[model samples]
Target: MTLLALKNISLRFGGPPLLDGVNFAIERGERVCLLGRNGEGKSTLMRIVTGQQQADDGDVMRSQGLRIAEMPQDVPKGLSGTVREVIASGGGKVGAALAEYHHLLHENPDDLDRLGSLQQILDTQNGWALDARIDALVAKLDLPADTDFNALSGGLKRRALLGRALALEPELLLLDEPTNHLDLDSIAWIENFLADWDGALLFITHDRSFLRRLATRIAELDRGQLTSWPGDYDNYLRRREERLHAEAQEVALFDKKLAQEEAWIRKGIEARRTRDMGRVKRLYEMREQYAQRRNLQGTAQFTVQDAERSGKLVAEAKNLSYAAGGKTIARNFSTTVLRGDKIGIIGPNGVGKTTLLRLLLGQLHADSGEVRTGSNLEIAWFDQLRSTLDERKTVWENIAGGKEYVELGGARKHVMSYLQEFLFTPDRARSPTHVLSGGERSRLLLAQLFSQPANLLVLDEPTNDLDVETLDLLEELIVDFAGTVLVVSHDRAFLNNVVMRTLAFEGDGRIGEYIGGYDDWLRQRPVATARPAAGTKPKPAAVPVVATAPASKSPLDSKQKRELAELPGKIEKLEAEQEALGLKLATLYASDPGKAVETQKALSAIEQTLATAYARWESLESLRDA
Candidate 1:
């Protein structure tokens, strides 16, 4: 059954329509992930569907008694009172009933019927358990229950808001960038939570792993349109390409027909003595139809201008110790950075990932520590705070900064050209920094970072507001760049793609270095047995006990044993080629889109061959025993 239906949804503000006659529906138990580049009207459409905002022209229908709990990208302001009090009072069924009961008693000293009805609802919904639920969430999220909501930092505030939303336990959950400020552990915790959510879920997140694990369907809100594919993120990519290819074919067919009609009207109409007016009008209609599909564009293109090379040793830290306000950030931490090193930094919130980055850059003073830097090191910083952006200045002004031109790759390029490289048209270039979306702002930052001759790049949560496509591009560039990169990100898939190693913050001011990326780090770390509570199940133990191996197979015959020995070698070669193809796919994706397709097919074929070899080898070993 349809839980929500949005029909002919259209909205506009001064400029072109942000959403143009959009139509879609959410059925019960459907988990849909809404994706779009920053500022592509995703939030606007969400508001329309949730009844927080009315569409300029559309119809929205919600099933009777439908309940929704939402977590906005930015935490709401004016939230006062203790964290526990605010979160426990999100006004879900139990909370609402309890509050209403008290209100009626306050207004009239005695209202028995209303009081009884409200109390029944409160009891049925387990309203009294609100405190327990709120406490559990606060503890799990590492938030202080007694603190004032306003006193917490921005990240803490977002964490509290998420806890509140989760505590509400509504039938439908609407989350905007839910994992934006979460740490690796919290992100994983929430991923598991969403995995078991028994509701209609619609969330907007840039975390690719999260999307892959949670989304049963993927929806793209692009340039005033809503399109959906019936699968996870990977499947969505292939489907999107196929749909675009089909649309291209349709456009080609229309063009072919249009050409014939135009030719007939121009030269075959009796030397234009009497115009076939109907035929002429038909040609005009076809022209409009052709332009319509072609006009539909993506959010924006992303391109990273190449950077200059750096020396072998980018920077080094020995016994780095830093603390502020009686809290230790990093203690006796040390690491060496070599050129072309793409290292990822990950840790829990406030565990000093950002602090470590700053210390390496000499932005922070590390007490009693000596740091060595390469002579050719030129650093480019992508700050999560975005403090470098001038909100009052236009986009072009921010990039140009009181100059008519900028220096890119040691060449004096026009400011317009530099801005256009980031997909900024002339009109948008003039728009102020405050007007751009988060993704656009991120792109703008990249444009600025690439323009300068930087050998060392420091990124702090750089993927926070970027789309999946842009993330892919950034990953490729990081992997292929000739500089040293230190990126602090919670995006696991991105970290795996870009970084070869990771410097992890393992609580209590300690930093642990892992051999590979996020997944590798996860595999090496000890699993935490999360304390279970109401509505939460205890996690399975880290290592499950396995039964003894089946009775040893009888000794294989000489021929069977020989084939078995050769099978291992054959499988190894196939696997090696598959790994090579994976790397080739990355390079091919950046250089030639056409070859990427062929490379993927080849990779699939290799997997099948390897599977067949393994199956045959196993069967032969069993046959020899028989």
Candidate 2:
């Protein structure tokens, strides 16, 4: 069944339309992701769906009595209640059911009819099993049961809020930038939870891995238009590239045809000048026809100078450390950057990825160790804050230093051509840098960086505000770059595509070097470090196994062997019944109003039976294995 639908939705914010004639729908149990660069109306669309904001002109259709829960981008300030209390405040039938369950458990009711009425509500709401669900959700988000919600860290608070949202068990869940403040462990936990969740999910996030694992479809907002592609992020990107390439070819063919026609008109005009006025008139009409058929020019080209050769050692650091706000961010850190190296710096927020970048660039001095650069190295750095550019200057002046150049056509072109490649038009190129958006500033910086020659590139969060197209261009530039690069980014896709190695910032001022991309680093990270506080000591490295014993005969005794052989069949039969019951419940709820109440009762009974069968099968299987 369709949960929500938007028809011909359009929204404007005092300027151009942010969303124009957008039509989208969310079906029950579908996980759709809203994707776009910042200020592209993703958040606006979420608000419209939740009824917090109304579209300028459109209709929103929602199922009757449908419940939706949203996690806002910013947490409310000065929240007076405890974390647990806040989580329990999700409104709707679940909240009412929980209240009734509490009343039935504690209040001694002299009226038997009222007590029985409360009991029925409790069963209908699944209130008896709510505690187990809450526990599971809290554990999945890695939140401690007794931790004070008011006193928790920012990351922990975010998790606690997400846990509360899940506890509501709403039919639709809306999460915006869910992983923005989470650590890697928390991110992994959320990924696993979303994988198993059986409700409709609509979220906006920058974590590529999370999107790839959870999203069933991708919807991208660009230039006031929404384009949806069915499948994961990888599939969307693949198809987008194919479409772009095809469009480029078509544009090229149009340009070729226009050029051929123009040439023929030029020859005809030259021949008719000496022959007849009628021929000249005809040639003029042909010239006008060819002029109107000219294709729009493509974006300007990006060219970079070959990087100069560097010494064997590109960078070196010895026992480098830094402390801020009574926290040791980097301590006793040492690494060597050799020639032709591409390294990525990754870690949780405030773990010192940016601090390390500053240390390498000599912007900050370490208290103990040394940072040494290779001989004759030229560096071009892209700062996360974009502090390198002068905000008071025009984009053209910033790139060209107030210079003008004459092209082959003898028309004077300002440095706007370079800016246009980064999506800036002629008028926008004349605007002050202070007014540029974050994404525009990022692109302008890259255009300026590539314009100049540098051997060592240091980029901090280069993918922060870039769109998919700009990111692709940057990736291509890095791959073709012959120089060394050290990038710090939280974008997994960008890191995997651009970097060859990783420098991870471990807590307590230590850094670990992982020998691959983000995925490779995840696989090796489990054994890379040990947390004694988590009640597990580091294990010794494993040796290669040369041989293993194999047995064709059953190892168990006769009685156990018979039980083990029968357990598999019993478990399979129970699983099939459980699946059938679940499907029946779904269909009944969708198609038959009369069967809805009956199906709920039947579902509860089937669930109980399935639980018993599963327990018995598990016991037999365990005994056989033992």
Q: Quick one: best lDDT, which candidate?
A: 1
- Taking all chains together, each candidate's TM-score versus the true structure is 0.80, 0.64
Which sections of candidate 2 miss by over 4 Å?
Answer: 11-20, 36-41, 72-169, 180-183, 222-227, 241-309, 321-324, 387-413, 430-438, 448-451, 526-626
On TM-score, the leading prediction is 1
Candidate 2, which ten residues in sequence have the lowest lDDT sum? 528-537
- Cand. 1 Cα-lDDT: 0.78
lDDT of 1 by residue, 1-626 (tens): 66787878999897668888887777777788999766678888889877889998878888898888888988776667667656765756576565455557667648898898877776777876774676677787778877778887767777788777877777888989888877777777777777777888999999999999898667788778887655458867876787779978987888899999878777854667787788789889988876665244443444345455677877789998888878888888899988888899987777778888878867777887787777666788898888888999999888888698997656788888777767788899999899888788888888877777677889999998888777877887788777788999989999988898899876677788888988788778654422332346777658966888787666777987789879989999998997787656544533443465566568768878988998998898787767
Instruction: Compute the lDDT of residue 248 as modeled in candidate 1.
Output: 80
Return the clash pairs for model 2, or none: none
RMSD of each: 8.7, 12.2
Model 2 scores a TM of 0.64
RMSD of 1: 8.7
* Residue runs of model 1 more than 4 Å from their true location after superposition: 14-16, 92-127, 253-270, 274-278, 294-308, 526-550, 554-626
